[model samples]
Target: MAYRTWQCENCGFLYEEEFGLPLEGISPGTRWEDIPDDFVCPTCGFAKSQFSMIEI
Candidate 1:
């Protein structure tokens, strides 16, 4: 699978699908689409809508 990286528009926090935020309860390999809508950025506490898919 091609994992994607999502960036927080508020704080530039990167959420890599290949390495989910385990400390935030999101397991590794979790897909971006699978994440809940209510999920917030761990760094800035911004909503999921604040994130944008980033190509790397």
Candidate 2:
């Protein structure tokens, strides 16, 4: 499956599925759909819902 990148609408934080946030406890290749619903943006504290699918 093609990996996708998501960006936080609030802070421009990019979440690349190809390089999951290891510091955030997210393993590499972790899909956006697999992230917890309550996960917040590390940069802005925005809710996951605030992210939008973006092309890299």
Kindly give the stretch of ten consecutive residues in candidate 1 with the minimal lDDT sum.
1-10
The models' CA-based lDDT, in order, is: 0.95, 0.97
Stretches > 4 Å off in candidate 2? none
Predicted structure with the largest TM-score when compared to the true one: 2
Candidate 1 TM-score over all chains jointly: 0.93
Alpha-carbon lDDT of model 1: 0.95
Each prediction's TM-score versus the true structure: 0.93, 0.97
Evaluated with lDDT, which candidate comes out highest?
2
For model 2, how does the per-residue alpha-carbon lDDT over 1-56 read when each residue is reduced to its tens digit?
A: 99999999998999999999999999999999999999999999999999999988
Q: Which stretches of candidate 1 lie over 4 Å from their true place?
A: none
Task: Look at candidate 1 and tell me the lDDT of residue 34.
Answer: 96
Clashing pairs in 1: none
